[model samples]
Target: MARTVVPYSSLVANGSLAQPAGTTIDQSNGMYIAAARPELTILRVANTNGTDRVVTIKAGDNPPALAGGQGDLAVTVAATSGVQFIGPFESGRFIQADGTIEIDFAASFAGTITAFRVPRGT
Candidate 1:
């Protein structure tokens, strides 16, 4: 059986600004939830440091679940670089009770992560 999802305000928006002495996006083991039951439209992780950065993003709030031979799901960004994952919002892809998104990175590097999502169900 398929569950029906309620429609929310498509104009709802949320994000965070991480900067030097701003928001430490390092080994603090931080987690951010965009919205409750969100349909993600855009997700971005930007490296604003002067060196390479190792960033890890996990779906949901669990530690990690690797299906393939691939090791820790991570991305390496060069100095002063960024990466964005953008596409049409899907119900199952970004849906979470609070749209939980986890991000971890090396201590030496600095960066900012943000996501744009619309929570399903009013």
Candidate 2:
């Protein structure tokens, strides 16, 4: 199955940022984002379930075959309206060969997920 692509909401400097109605998490196929400038990308995960859920940012396979490889980052979002902001990913460690970052969910998740890209300055 194809992964869900999360569109990025660009942030403006010295301006008001609109709140987004994020996309629903694709627990089955997972998700991905075009990470051209990974260092400026951020992910927002909101959990609306009664139980805590784990969100995993799968590590990239770029520059493979090293002594010690990077592992996936797993973050726990607290239950009931809990929100977690993750990233500003390192390109070499999180950007895939196809120029995107992959995300996975430990289990069925409730709520929405949003991606944000910060401007170069501020």
Candidate 3:
């Protein structure tokens, strides 16, 4: 899977992402954020698969390696559905210092996740 620093406006703007389209993630490939870590307020996860999928999030810049059950919080998205984790969250809740904020999957599936932050640009 490919992951990069996408614009925080990607959620509000009605347009395509400057980054590449999202791919499948599972035991083999998982989403990783390492380039730039800024405090994010919104997290949108869209699952395009035929079956339901679970999205796992670990917040930190130097978090432990993925070994299943590494999620600080996990949310399940129904098949072909989407959900947004909105936040003007408590301090340290939505912030990622470096690349420590990791978003992963429990099973291989097709989906896209975009994060939005205030005064964007990292």
Candidate 4:
């Protein structure tokens, strides 16, 4: 039997989730998955500076599918604001795999995120 492990990761940004330098997903950063299960994982985030930060997770192509048509996983943080719980969204609702997923703050305060997991009976 073949086994698969979800590509667990997280990102934190100052001022905005979108940035010129953007963010990176790795151990050197302050984000990491401390606990994980077949269906869920706990992410730990520590605010380094006073500036409100936005953290996000982006699944490449072939993300886990949601059980229902709950929609793609997307996170939205208001301007100059931060969010704690971002998802449980469907992976298919965001975009096609032809290009990178983008979250434009100039267009809206809402951000795009990956669905945390699919519902049962998908």
Candidate 5:
């Protein structure tokens, strides 16, 4: 199955930014971000499940030899109302061949996920 795309919410420099409702966790197909500027991207995951959930950020496959060599990034979100922020990824490590970053959930995740990017020169 294809991965779900997570749209990025750009942050305003001197103004207030509206909060997004975010996308529901797609445990089955996983997720991806069309990362134009990976260094500025950030991912937010809110877990409301009763048990801890693991989220993995798949590494890049650019050099092949380095693919999976560095290992994927795994984050554990605490049970019930836990919120985690990940990213500002190093393009060399996480950007995929299709110019995106892939993300996966170890198991079913309960809650919403959002992606954010800081404006350049901010």
Candidate 6:
């Protein structure tokens, strides 16, 4: 069954989503769960050093997964060298690299990056 999600609101009036109790917010080896449906939301990742990064996201057990790409080619992100689209379904697989992906995204994105794995080839 699809898990019901709620709309995201600023509990502090700063337009920042509040972290749920017992939720992990570490950028290194951590994960971030966005609101039920994220509209006009952007997610970005940057390496602390000029090194390569590799990350992956396994599919969940839901539907209407996250969207990938931008504009015309704005399709679902499959897999890339340093960039990847997590997924829209409840379950999927994702792997991202930093040095490998230089121009994967067309639109500018900004969001909290949840890294649960150390960057490979760093």
- Minimal lDDT window, size 10, model 2: 61-70
- Candidate 4 lDDT at 71 equals 35
For model 5 the local lDDT of residue 72 reads: 89
Candidate 5 lDDT over 1-122, as tens digits, reads 99999998988987778889999999999999885467899889999899999999988876632444687899999999999998888877887777888899967688889999888875
Clashing pairs in 5: none
Query: How do the residues 63-106 of candidate 1 rate in per-residue lDDT, one tens digit apiece?
Result: 22222223234668777866544333333433333454445567
* Candidate lDDT values, in order: 0.47, 0.84, 0.52, 0.31, 0.85, 0.27
Clashes of each: 0, 0, 2, 14, 0, 11
Candidate achieving the largest lDDT:
5
50-107, model 2: which lDDT tens digit per residue? 9999999888774531211577889999998999999887786777777888899867
Q: Candidate 2: where are CA atoms >4 Å away?
A: 64-68
RMSD of each: 9.6, 2.1, 6.3, 12.8, 1.9, 14.6
* Angstrom error at residue 90, model 3: 6.1
Q: What TM-score would each prediction reach against the true structure? A: 0.49, 0.91, 0.55, 0.28, 0.91, 0.28
* Model 1 regions more than 4 Å off: 1-26, 34-41, 59-72, 86-99, 118-122
RMSD of 2: 2.1
Off by over 4 Å in 4: 1-38, 63-122
The number of clashing residue pairs in model 4 is: 14
RMSD of 4: 12.8
lDDT of 3 at 96: 52
